[model samples]
Target: MLFVRKSYILPTAFLLSLIYLLFSSLPPAPEALDIDDREFSPPPKQNGGQIHWQKGREKHPIKSYIPLPTAAAPLPIPKIQHDFPSESWYRRRQRVNRQTAVKQAFEHAWKGYKKHAWLHDELSPLSGDNRETFAGWAATLVDSLDSLIIMGMTDEFEKALAALEQIDFTTTDATQINVFETTIRYLGGFMAANDLTDGKYPILLKKAVEVGEFLYSAFDTRNRMPQSRWQWTRTAEGLGIEPSRNTILAELGSLTLEFTRLSQLTNDSKYFDAIQRITDQMEAAQQKTKVPGLWPVMVNAEEMKFTDPRFTVGGMADSMYEYLPKEYMLLSAQVNQYKSMYDSAMDAIKDRLIFRGMTKDNQEVLFAGNAQAGMPSKEDLEHEAEHLKCFLGGMVGIGAKVFRRSAEELRIARGLTDGCIWAYDSMPTGIMPEIFHVSACDDMDDCKWDEKKWYRDVQRRLSKGTSAQNAQQEGKSLVKTHGLAPGMTDISDARYFLRPEAIESVFIMYRITGDKTLQDAAWRMFKNIEKITRTDYAHAAIYDVRDRHTPKLDYMESFWLAETLKYFYLIFSEPTLVSLDEYVL
Candidate 1:
């Protein structure tokens, strides 16, 4: 459902009635609340634990280094003007129960990982085995540390802190490492945990510094650009490495937030300087791309040039665009380049990428799609959407509010979010697939369902050898076989990877607009995902979200705990707990 802000207040008697109907059926409070006032003991010290860089090591005295500028004021938290009274006791209790439910789910998965795959990158919930997708560095443990503290699981947080002490950044089982994933999940995790605890735990910062040094080795090239995928083993051995000639936009552009945060915390400009160079290159190339405002998916990291004409806000380019506004906020609005770059990219996205999807119910939803350089015009937008692009709604929402953009941006954000919610509801298991195709509506404001057009589109996609009548008959069978939703004609990739993008946006929209309907949408998404993905140990990814009896993939990514459940918990908890005004989260 499209979320519209509540502009009116209910009468006292009607308010009470509404509360009773809303919360009376909610499950009773659990034995314990998700949050508590418990405190944690400091973790034991490591003996001079620090990674030594073999080359390009520089030290800046605090006196000589200038700290990044801070904003004059924090972004104001938006408040609904309606005179809805303070939360009723029933509503508060219901929120606590929902938060508790999310906390319990996190605990189940944490216990499973601790028991079955401690110190590994990820846990195979179904197989009860460990997998090292990201340097075998206890990714889930580190990633979930801040989430644990935010949920008031002090004991679990303390245990995770202790486990963090045993991690060795000097070595890894994998010869090569992905710089982007490591920076976000590992470095971002440690930095976030450190920030949440008010810097009480020195070990978190220490671990972060160690990981940062290891990642910094990727930038030791002729040019300051980093290797998207680095041979860490060679770097550890003091061997030489070069930046990749062909790298995606995300790998080169997503490092700013984490690296900049590290510099702010440690007062070392080395990390920030590395990423700033990349940002400067991106800004210089902004207008040089085939699509002037947007960067292509692939680029030459060494030459710092766009290498592909294909542009998308999906897989290879999502976080690059995502980090622009976030980095602006994180840097306290001191850097105007980030703002300029973000505005340019978003303008291109709104003009060339967004499309209206014509669903069977004729729902008016907007989706961010793909574009090619040689397209005849902006109207030739690809009608494919990816789950990863769902984050755009929240990103755009934050930009709109923080930058004081027009109300049109907020409206666009709502349409984008509604598109994702529709995808989830339209699926049989109530989870959007990784990638799917939809029928395009000619007009964004005036969309209509046309079954004949859908059938014709399907017929045209069939093999050339097939007869027209046979093609039409086969199209119907294909629809049933693929479990295509009413407006959908094909399923490109149907797997669901326990992603957090959709819920992430839902949580953000709820916070920014204070919309109760977004919470309802989040609750339905959580329940459907938990029901379909849960196993005896923990939740697993599904083979296909459109299948009623889909098999489970034996995988659990760290973001499942770090982002998915964390967002769910935050949405159900008090808004003041992680107030948007105080943090860039």
Candidate 2:
């Protein structure tokens, strides 16, 4: 919990000595990704609407910026070629193979959920029982609807669509439902399917609108900031039930994309107005905050004020920041506010949150952490990164390319992407951990090599010979040698919740860069996940990624289908299927 001051610059001699001591027994650290070392200095006034970034080694490539919409020139709709074989023959075949594998994996989990936890929110993969979470809503089924459509599971999609009749978004049996979760999963899923199918499924639109109406009740507050949770059935007119006054940034900010899309589809401005007000309030309030582009994680609904001014791209506020640039892409480039906010936020992230740590071998490693206002005299600073935060890497990279931003910005995007991979690469299971400790090496007391067992295992495996004895040995050795257990720094908690952020970025990175290496890496990680997480009932979450024999956590989260499997399929699918250049997540 030690909080190091940014102003306290350590001498080179001290840092080198510490690094030498830490890596004396281990090999040199892996080559770190190149980070843009540009100085951040904002111009007094933006010239020609172009942002000025510090000149660096990377060259900024200029492309035609989509002009803001006007009455004379309407915003152009982004269109993608949905037909298969849009990519090269070899790449399309690779995608089809990967897509089939993902489909099988998803069906395995879905069959189990259907058999044991049908009509329930989630499945207990180990117990084969319903979890009854999320107000007894069929969360997994509803959440998986869009995924089924994406994967072309027609029969399964129809069956799931029919099953939706039993779901009632109106009544929650007095159980309070999360406004954010309900909106994102149910409303978002429904609208996504409706959009993907070109509104052929009226029922999906109907469900989304119904839930959107119930969700609208939470916006009854004076500030227009939606409450975190709501109990629609308990209230008359859905207005009497008092919603929570305090809410997190993600709940308030993440609504823009889905709600706005709903409004566009229905031609009802209320849905868009409900969320636009929140962003208007946010932009107005941004002037008073210490950091540009970043808002406090928590806010008071009643007062319409930020309560906790700590800035982070982590849980509770991650998606809020992500939606800024995306909203601009989805709606109109003329919505310059989205671009401004996103740009400022990126600056704050680079200036305050981003850092470089010297590994045991004096190698530089890039990592990002959260930043809080007002230095703490006695409190310890958090240097741990979460799996949820990994999505920022893809989001950043996607934004840079879509907006045709500076090359330095793209480097930041790639660097952050590499950082996410580093998290998985440094782990023992070759899977990303739920949470991990990241310490900056400053002195002998701070630098210590504790992953002795992992290093010894690596040495033993290396000495046995580089050549594999058989296929199993090859698979094991390949994963182990690359990242399976290339022990560097050990993580604190090693749970794998079947989260998709890492693979999600891999997919996005592959699409943006067209790098075959990314595709291969994703395949290796997919194999590792499939090998360890497969259970008789479903693909269960592991209690610890470090142990293949680790007990199952029992709970199968809805996102395992909604995001994880979806990303896996899309990563391997034809890149042009859902072109990153044309779409915003």
Candidate 3:
């Protein structure tokens, strides 16, 4: 009986020990929070404010994932002028109200696009039909993705995000597309969306890679200069032929921003190398040109040489010059080459391209015109300044802010900005024309024949490299002292495509100077634009800004949303939203 009892006790004890071990291995029950505590607790901070990741073994990390800046950069608060109502409450309320209005405007346009032109490159407000300016790639939707985030349209953003899956970049054909437009509108939009989303979507990076793979084919030339357009060959082994031997400056030089970011993100040198070759070629060509910073508007892609001797900061070359200072800032100022290029270009522009003219009121106005390599002609001098060239104003202002140590640059920026404003104010509608003629201060309005003394004075100052302050003072004196003849300016091309240059400059100037006048002017101009361009479906470009009743142009450019509206939105929003100190754009 004692032996049997000992056996049963040993077996029971063994079973009890096994049960204890199993219970000990199980996870503890989650601790209940204090009843009054917030429902969603913030992540715990550790090791100097870094949020601690949840304790776990990370698994199945993807190789294509590229980490973007997850935190908002520490940037300076853009200050309003102390002279303009010192009450902080007033300014805060103003900003909030402006932001709300801009948000509503954006939503109105977006809804119209989704309803009428969904999955298309552009919206034709007049026709309510879809158009494909961007290789049939639904550019409006892709470009609008980041703008949605900026406006805090989460529901629309998610819808657009889901729609991105339908965009199949893998399918290639002989359909040619503009490389520069695609890079800026599509590639830029994608990268921006990814950055704003804190890299939540790896799909954006993947699409960029896919698109870039085909674009690289444009660089496969003997001279390493990229063609303006690209298409894939039938076999898919090689790319389609170049559209022509000649390529424009903006098309070639504006690529560095997008491609360099791609390299940094993917750790791929091929993208960087492609654009680097263009930079190398431009640097070498800089030595060959008579002007230090300026190149001809057109270059032979095959020979890697400039084919056009005409130099202008307008049309096909504006963005190239604009990108120099921006690229320097975007790359954290590590690249000095970009600054050097910008300096030389500005010097060339001041020396050769700048022209001082007079209005009918005899106000001495300074303008930038095209420069010929040899000598100026009567017809060439008569060519009107384009609305596109007005971007020079903002570019100069931004350049001054970046190169702040240089007082002369600041003066130049101010002068150019002021000149652009004058151009806008001179028109009857207070909206600058697509193109307008400027002439010497005379009743005849023939600037080409007058050969005025102010022109010679401008040439002398430019040649001497006058201090920007002195140059600016001199410009003001030209306007104040030698008032240009009234009626000397005339509208040549009255059409308005809803361009963003003048408004963009106004926004930049307002931010830098803290001048409330600029904001007021922008608001008034925006109202005018809405009155003239608003359509039943969406806004359409007008045949003329001077005529409110002008015919609709029947086409809404993709840039209308991507750049124009986006700029306006940023302009009205709180400056800290995307502080220039932090964001390169």
Candidate 4:
């Protein structure tokens, strides 16, 4: 009996030791908290105040995802000069009504896309058909994600989040991927959505990682310069790809913001390193170009040289300049080079590219024009302006506020914004054309409209060649039919692609200046766009903004929802919803 008791005691002691070891290795149970307490609990801080991942589902402040730059002094709050009286009850009601109208417009478009064009890049709003312009990865849905969230469309946002899981970033229908467009529309869309949601949805970041990795493969060259258009299928087959010798400025330079943000989110420096290399190359080449301060539209990526001398703050070169100030803010002003670069470029732009247009009403407004190599004089500038260039107003406005630039900069911003507004108001349909030519004023402040000079200018172009004569005739016919405001010469491109640049500036100006007139302008523009562009299915682009009976283009771009309607909705929203101080948009 004694021997049996000793054996049982030994076995029981061994079992107790094993249980103690197992329990010691496990994590301690969390302190019990009520639902409210749990919901309000702060996330664990890691990576210098960045939110550390916690188990299960949780939401954090937006600053945790996109933290304000702490490396430098915080920027000052913009002193917005309110130009209107305190908001009356009637005015408040009207603004709320407008916000609802914009929301309804969004729902109409979203419903059409979900029903007809799910998983497609765009929707043929008139026909309810799917169009694949950007790899059929559901560009519209992804791009519209943050916008839906901002508008508080909870149901639509949930549905979008579910559909987002269906996208396979590993493959696409297109053989060649446009690096620039995909980066802006897809990669940017994903990052913004994730940031705005405070990283509650992990799938959004996962998909962003997949897409970012795929795009990073484009930088596998000897110089680490990316191929603006990448052929991934060839690369996947072990056949190498090379960066394009000729790439546009925007395609190469507009990637810093997205990649830098990706690195911040994932704690991976590789993505930031890739874009930093590009930024270094650009900084090195800033003064070496034909124009000392501005980069040309076409650049030689292989040699890192500017092959084209033509520069415009419009199409191929706009966003590159845009990203400069934005990246500076995004990095919390840790990089002073961007601010210097932006200042130098803006100085050059004001001196060479910006010109004053003499209006029929004898009003003077600023327009950003084009510059050619070897033509440094004001006389050599192109008086043509594009709808795309209208964003400069907002860009400059933000720069002035952030960089604390001179009051002259703010004045120039207001003038540039007013110029675009005048263009819209002067048009027959109350919508500006894609591109147009205006008469330049010799003196910005003291110029009068000259009918004789306008006729002579037309005749001089007509005498140049038969093609010129035909162009003049076409311009004349458009003028007669559409009724041009004086000091306007011709309509170069009449189509409207549901552009948001003009309204983008209007929105920014409203936020920066607290100008009631800007809102009025936005309201007018929205009403005109809604009335003219709306269809039974959804809104469509019009072939000609001047023609009331213009045919709908059957397609609605992702920006129509992502940018246009978002700007419209925000213009009428509470100013603090997406405060400029808090967001780069």
Candidate 5:
């Protein structure tokens, strides 16, 4: 519609020189455009190594991109930690405090609480005839706790954190012990938020150090991380690598946060170096996993060959990009390539695995490989709900934000907003299901986990009465001991949809741009939670999925849920620099 035909007359030599400079530095643009910016579903073979980005499904199928294996590099990924530069002495004090950091330290504590070793959201909080299993609780807790903390509601947060004090990270628990939380969430959030509350809050640089040391000890690096996702019980210590043992996705993503703090707090290049150690290893691991140049969910420590590709490690991608771009200033040209590759990976996520809006029914139609687009059909309801939530959650959290796809990013953001509203309004009760499988696993054991009784129960439930629809709501009449509501599946993990984690992304969207549309959207969420829902904290249970898991009084997530909700409420109603800066990550 708008074209300008004016051409500046420049010397041929000058024009030629300018063109050369541009091409030398810029990333290559692909010949084809990426699929839709939202609801992008990718098979495992879609993007091994192709960088042009605009190929439809066939252009770049998923395959691992294995870099040549070499001994671990001696240097850690370099850091650009020069301090805030223009920042002052008082601010620095707040950023590095010990005692004054107490306020924030507790926040770090809850981040610890949400880890795999501790009381998960649903099970730990309310166990009895009507309680839930460990996994159910953690999923819920991750949401509730993340939201509550962000909202500035610390009292309840402290209670949850205190609950975690009872568990020891060194011991094996029912669920996987999360090295990520032990390192990143607790350390990163505290250290970053230091003096962040208007210099009123002090930093707990020491606490962050303590957490890192503890994580290093727990991981021991040799044992690798826990075996939950792969379904290996800690008891089954020698389980094979075919299923994942260490969760590198969590491991590396958390490193970005923890290392950022270490670099700032110690002024020690070494602490920051340690972070680079993990990231560089991950980069190399990606290279190792490159079936042609694509990444899979999990890989072995030694071989570098992928254990599985179905899991794409979205969180890993998010954190890597979040820290790397700025970290580019820290590296020599050779190492700086890490930042370049990471940026491209981010572009790839935008290019695929994202969509404007997709119908849950159609997407969850079978397993989760890829969905065309449309709302869930009646037959698809129970499976698609949670899958959509996590998929959208990862995008909203940091992927969409870092990529800076303003319009396209916003569209992906709305997918969550609209999807949730649709789920709540359309579902007979507000309940969402545990998961929607996309790909098929030839091994039945692979499709289901070895350790999780919760998953097993659901598998049994689905198998009963001939099919998912006719299946009797297994475990009806809430088990207060385990907190199993009838219509709901496992409460702990299911609670991810509850609390504030569900809405924090919306708040972030609002915070970044301060768009009224986002705010309005957020307000709609707030009202639905506050007024339309049952209780202040419950966010009002909507469990019509199968049976009555509980009275729906159950709000058993870790704590992120409440923090997220509170964050949205404050930004939506108050809308100020003071409030916004306090929660800055």
Candidate 6:
């Protein structure tokens, strides 16, 4: 009994010693993560401040510009003037509101895309903070940023700028040449936003120049192509990666716009020339077209020259034109030719495509009137998104500058964006579905369920993260309820439209002319989404609160919400906030 007792005590003693040793060997707790009991500062004296507006006010040229030392209006608050701002400095609050809604929806939809680190071989969009994703996400970020600066939200905009810092675009990394979209989306938007925000958040011009140089050097003689994909050839260490062929038109259009923007920012003639080369390439390419059209999505850069006209022309063609006319205005004096081309193109597009509405069954597309033009195939989703982007971009360009679109054109654009929003408002609570394509199947006569099967199939594959079962169910439900050609479904769910691209156009209207309605809209959308805020997958935004395990944040895609929301918040805000106008230009 004594021997057993001794053995047990010895074993227990040994175990206790080991435990203490292990505890002692462990490192101390991290100091950075400590949540200390914080101390609060003393409250300030509430009433002793004297009213001296003159102390803060700078002397101006006119005596009328100066104000007396005392507060100008009621106690505490001065009488703030809401006067007519300069024509160029016009504010678009109404449009900015709608753009905010666009961002809210865009954020939820964009989270489904894969990360760059995952796709080590293929082009990953979310490669860096400037861009983790390619053009699609970048465009969303810029669009959102546009609204953000307008709304007077500097905190969020700064966060976005911080996120962009992750993308280091150096000439040494040849394969890492996806900086073009960042320039167009982040840099350009920042330049414009900084201009609007009183210089609080300008993109560094030196970085822009460095990025522009990288972009300029990448384009080869093969129709001014930028390397879409690249990898180290193992030929040399310092020389960097070898280039892979295939550059998409959509990206090229993106590059062209950046070049144009850089030229404007830097006054470098070379950027203008680089932009011209893109148009030259567009002219060089050939593709099928029913009217003034061309495919914007390039599958095979060498073999396919803008094939599939209906899907491509809307965004790619229009985007290409974005930099061209502006760059032309800067380069040569023949502005008349540019104006003429726009007019001619407008006529062609009006005649060939675009139906005003579907109020009448005849306009419902398919039988003889508007519907007879054939539905888009599953392959055309990319095409449609591109066209939608370009169409909106072109209209904004044309309406804002070219020909000063008739009151009718302005009305049309307003109607178009409004219609898009109304469609989203009417959509089913959760996800937005793919489009209800017009009936154009040649074999429709043989199959009764072509509409349901086609769209259901298309939506599942295209709408980013939707499940196949859900897509089919929605497709069948839409077809069963509405049936055949010309029926309407919640196509607003398309990540392309859900983003703030259209709202950017609306913001243009507000900017060109001071409109308080835009400001009201921006405020309303912010409040609306704020109510819907829910955390998912460790990210936060105006999320689909119903879903769990999806925080729904893609830095690139969410930039639209992050930036544009801030833009709308800034311009109409109290003067105490930081200025954006100085930084953007």
Per-residue lDDT of model 4, residues 258-352, tens digit only: 88777767766567666776877888888888888899998888778886979899998899998898787676565677999998899889988
Distance (Å) between predicted and true CA of 478, model 6?
A: 4.3
lDDT of 1 at 497: 94
Kindly give the stretch of ten consecutive residues in candidate 3 with the minimal lDDT sum.
1-10
lDDT of 2 at 73: 32
Q: Would you list the C-alpha lDDT of every candidate in the order shown?
A: 0.79, 0.65, 0.63, 0.77, 0.37, 0.38
Candidate 1 all-Cα RMSD:
13.1
Name the weakest run of 10 consecutive residues (lDDT summed) in model 4. Answer: 1-10
For each candidate, give its TM-score against the true structure. Answer: 0.87, 0.76, 0.75, 0.84, 0.50, 0.53
- Error (Å) of candidate 4 at residue 426 is 1.5
Identify the superior model by lDDT, candidate 2 or candidate 4: 4
What is the lDDT for 316 in model 1? 94
Indicate the residue-level lDDT of 79 in model 4.
42
What's model 4's lDDT at 307? 61
117-152 per-residue lDDT for model 1 (tens digits): 998989999999999999888999988888888899
Which pairs, if any, clash in model 4? none
Model 6 has an lDDT value of 0.38
Q: Per-residue alpha-carbon lDDT of model 5 for 1-585, expressed as tens digits?
A: 000001111123444344444433422211223435324433222234321112122222112111111112223322211111333566435323421232233344334444422444342222221233332223333334334444466776566445534432222333444545444445543443332332223323444454444343332222233222322132223223222444455444345445544543444333443454455555655544432223554445333345454333233433444445334322212244555555555454443343322232322111112222222422221222343343344234343443333555455555545544444333223433343222122231233322233333444433444444422333332233334432223333342234443455455555545444554555455444433333322333434333434345443333323354445444433344223222224
Give the lowest summed-lDDT range of ten residues in model 6. Answer: 1-10
Best by lDDT: 1
Report the Cα RMSD per candidate.
13.1, 18.9, 19.1, 15.2, 18.0, 24.3
| Candidate 5 residue-wise lDDT at 64 | 18
